[model samples]
Target: MTKQLASSAPDLPHLDLPHMGQVDDPWGGVGEGRLFTGAWVQARGGVIEVKEPATGRVLTLVGRAEAADVRAAAQAARVAQVDWAARAPTARAEVVEEAARVMGGMADTVVRWLMREAGSAGPKAQVEHQHALGFLRHAAAMGQEPQGHILASVPPRRSVAERVPLGVVGVIAPFNFPLVLALRAVAPALAAGNAVVLKPDPRTPVSGGFLIAQAFAAAGLPPGLLHVLPGGADVGQALCADPDIAMITFTGSTGAGRAVGELAGRHLKKVQLELGGKNALVILDDADIDLAARNAAWGAWLHQGQICMSTGRILVHHSLHDDLVTRLAAKARALPVGDPLDGVAIGPLIDPGQVARVDAIVQASVAAGARLVAGGTHDGRCYAPTVLAGVTPGMPAFDEEIFGPVAVVTAFADDDQAVDLANRGQYGLAAGVIGANVDRAVRLGARLRTGHLHINDQTVVAEPQAPFGGMGASGNGSRISGPANWDEFTTWRWTTVQPTAPAYPY
Candidate 1:
């Protein structure tokens, strides 16, 4: 909706995004052909148009939401939560199972839609759907397992603690993982018998909301149990500040997370946040250059480095600095780029604005005397995967979270220096360590500040068994792992019974 200056192409890497199809031209952020909020209603003066990064193809335009509408939606969700929670656990589980089956039927169409709407590559978009399905199935299974309790013996009495659902839960999700993150909140909330008020990013609502609504309907959830409130900050603020909402779970910037936390604190409601990360990828002296290069590339470019756990900063041993940069640069340059639908390695950014922001960050880093080693050109919203070397600790590329394809590489003379440098950031989300010596890798991995550390590998996604959350700025004390997820959604009420009356203590 706001007009900024158009920039000339910057000199960096030669990244090419494949031409997938005839994407619409953008106006404000509403794509010309797509049927969105603007299409359904009269054109409001201010609209932010989302464009494909690679070809300047207009993807969608998001109109600003009215605050009044958001309040009404939140109020509606609060009214519906009680009845939804009263449903039997098995009944809830059956709905979750049915959601999975419904999602499975529409998998292909959903993947393609995500590719167009979110600019996600085929493989990655497919994985989002898979994650959605997994969350649904896992939640259903969890529901079947009855709430557990511990027994205590005193005099001749019995005691037990049972889990019960929290009331209306507000879920504010991010754009990077539109569908997957939505399911993450929905599955657990529903399984624990809580109703959810979902505020998805307007950027990719159709792709995310359509699938979720379909799944909920197929699962036989109550009509008003889950409400989709798609809009921007106004909507989010309303939901967070509302006293009726029992809890708020958010995934986004630290600033936004703080705001949500403040609002929840004021209401004395629970808040779970997964915030920013300037995650580090530490390459030890013993790491295999070839494998490390491959892993580092994946860490930097997957989802265009939009992931919360993305490896934005690279800490390498000084001894192998040149070798590491050369390998990483070569691998990055070699990756095929173009259309997301064609299954290219890198797709366009969610919108042109993101591409511009990422490009500016890379340029500013270079202007500050950091060397651009490889990949940094922009065609519309499409930016080539870039590598930066000769970076020092104070540089923005090293100090900040660059949620883009660019990775900053800083050389460390020894293991101690590498550890020190990696721990310099405010974030403690996730990190990756590369080494040939198993013992050294294991030992050094323990020293990293991140909550999730991977040894000689890059795949560190959420697993049903493993806990996922950060230590410091990355999150509050919350994790979506095993039974912990179930615990977060429910509260424990201790109940005591007496077979025979106990004597009073004198």
Candidate 2:
């Protein structure tokens, strides 16, 4: 396999991973260790060849997880969760806090691997690292937060409500923003005393799976409380259907989320879903076009526009559409797109399939009358930043989440028309409205249906302690992180007691 990590990255939170009797010195990733099933155990489903998206080069071979592995993990987590739940809240918090400390020290190593595995740009990878640290620290604080509430009861009677762990939580993560998204669920669940079975997207097992395992293990998290299984659809289905798993937290496309929601529903499991978005960035008539164009470029091209909150379409005032289009087109063509290791601003997508999908959207939008203002080309998997003008509702560029470096621009006459256009699709994930008049922008944003909105900034933003989720097709409104963790990772237990015994009404 490729050269191992040179003495860096932790193993996991209390994982018993071993190669023979010891793990490889510089842990490259979980791929270097096969699979993590309380240990570095090989999966029964055989091996998968991990490849670099930019070069399509075989990076390493990792054992592919299957349905059986998911069951075994659930069974183990169910048993281990009792002890994890029994630990002092401080004890649980310490583990997560320590993981964050360790993660901070190994920033360079993690970013390097993230670049190789997910084809992420340097700044984008660094953002993931910092955001993950925030998630861990935020989750750590949840342990010491108020656990329950004192209730007002009639004299001689006492009643109270407290949060309790859900026993076992399943996390199904996506390739884009894998580390932060997986940790957004995994860290909080652990802090709240729920054992987790994390299924990283097969394409990003290391950053989303193994890297987490390593960090927690080094921090002295108890064994069997967390298991990282890198696998395909069967494993995800098993996780949702397993009896031992009490809940599922998922982040992916709307189509995949529907499937997950359907399966979890059949089994009567609590589910938290964060799905896709075709968000809008509204440039108001009174706004500064130059500043708006800069934000649009960053939102539309950062990490190749793979982020779910990336600007899917831009709505500009008809008066300034031409000027904004000219500025955006120039910015799009200037962005360097290629290997992330070469220190470029944009990189190749996760794979060739993503490239094909991006190309199809561009071609279809142009065919439907959207003008290709700039860039409509690709070299290998690297799609040049593209700008489309005159895009409208029926065009793919306007309606679809083009998870690539492409900016689709549409124009509107007033705030009502802008809000109507933003709410045209099923996506209600995120949106942005920028203008010189902050009050007007806020008023318009308030009218929009998105779960999150920016009055003067871009759509792509995430605060670790915010109520991070969406509504409609974007999610089932099962918000995560911040105060939402208590809702997702724990169930309420209302207890009542009398001095002796309750009087029977018989």
Candidate 3:
């Protein structure tokens, strides 16, 4: 912990964090910490003040990095990657496993920071921490798995193929699920024998990037192998343009993902992108209205609907459309909305800009003939959980990705219409179907063109061992998590040997 300071600006409120025993001043030392080249150094680009969205309070200052800083970090990673890749797989796995243990021990501290910095509720923070830990452990175990394959060759010859790391991987993580998203790429990259340069969202530098660096350092990972640079798009651009960065793994908006993909393509660097989604949740006439409402509420309102796979569109059978909307509106109104530290279901948006964006979308939808069932209001940075009915296919409310606590409902005539609506979107990230007939729901799910489909479940679901990604504009062809990640972070090389010299045809 470092010395705490008060906000000098009168408009900025005082910091108020949850009380966790013996974990005083979670924001302390944040401004002074920049993990580079195996050491915590001060940022030369100055500092940025992080504010808690729940109260508009200045939480702490974080060191900001610029292009020079990014270049330095990349150079350091390049230098360290050789030794990191040279180590035995078992030895690397042990270090990652130890890091997971250390992170689990600091769960309380990490959760508090997540709530304060990222505006994540207590439950959401817990989920992020648990997922991060699980992924870290899984990655450690994967380190010892087979990395190559043996293939039959011509007579008296042998052939083999092995997966190799892509030197230095640059990971740009989003603010929504900062901790888990960053670690999802970092853990696998490390396990596959690649060094990493992480650029966490500037808005959540402390909880998103700094904490992971601390845990890995404490777990005795060789210094310089991992670097956390907390900065904005300029830093990210620098990272992508760096000649030494062999690959880029990014999680953010589709627009931003396209820019990254383009830059990486121009540079001939491997890139993996997990972008936005306008996911849908369908309710059949035979479904239990209460269960459907509950699932819809949880899927649409969790983390204020910031998740990429949040159910943004709800398609219901015309027979049950009105009933489902009524029940869902009630569920939305009943949810607690307030400060994240207090364990509320709906917390503040990441910033005023987001609140304005969501509010504007809701207002526009209403003007465009969508009926507001409940919510559709904002107080400070907090937007109420909103439900809108009569949403049509062409409206922005139905067509766009509203990254907020907003759910749009549209009625469909039959299963064909429902599946058609689900598959109509350009984004094919995820979708959910709820029905009494499980077989029917599964059949419909098969027809929908989505990367992931849930029968009687919400779209917002992920496990560390599941192959998670999207199709079309939602993401690139690459997938992350589980064994699929190994393919993305590594390259394949084929080797061959002969027992005796053979004459060349030439």
Task: Give the Cα error of residue 424 in candidate 3, in Å.
Answer: 2.1
Candidate 1 per-residue lDDT, tens place, 1-506, comes to 00110111111111111111123421122232221221123223245454444555555443444555555555766677777777788888888888889888877666766666677776787788887788788888877787868677675677888888888788888888788877787788888888787777777665655457656765677766776656678778887787768888888888888888997888888888888888888888888888877787888889888888888788888888899889888877887666664557788777767777888888888889899989889666778889999998777888888888887889998888888988896789888889999889878879989888888886345665456778788888677645777767888888888887768897
Worst 10 residues of 2 by lDDT: 1-10
Q: Give the winner by lDDT.
A: 2
lDDT of 2 by residue, 1-506 (tens): 01133123222121234431122224444433367766678667877666667888655556688899999989999988899899999999999999999888868767876877788887788889999999999999997799899799986878899999999999999998889999999999999999999999888887888889888888988889899888889999999999999999999999999999999999999999999999899999999988999999988988999999999989999999999999998887777878777777888999888999999999999999999999889999999999999999999999988899999999999989999999998999999999999999999999988989998999998988898888788999889988999988999999988888867999
List the candidate 1 regions with Cα displacement exceeding 4 Å.
1-65, 153-156, 498-506
Q: Summing lDDT over every window of 10 consecutive residues in candidate 3, give the lowest-scoring window.
A: 1-10
Top TM-score model: 2
Top-down TM-score ranking: 2, 3, 1
Residue 168 alpha-carbon offset, candidate 2, angstroms: 0.4
Q: Please, what is the whole-model Cα lDDT of each candidate in the order they appear?
A: 0.73, 0.87, 0.85
Those runs of model 3 whose alpha carbons end farther than 4 Å from true positions after fitting are 1-35, 500-506
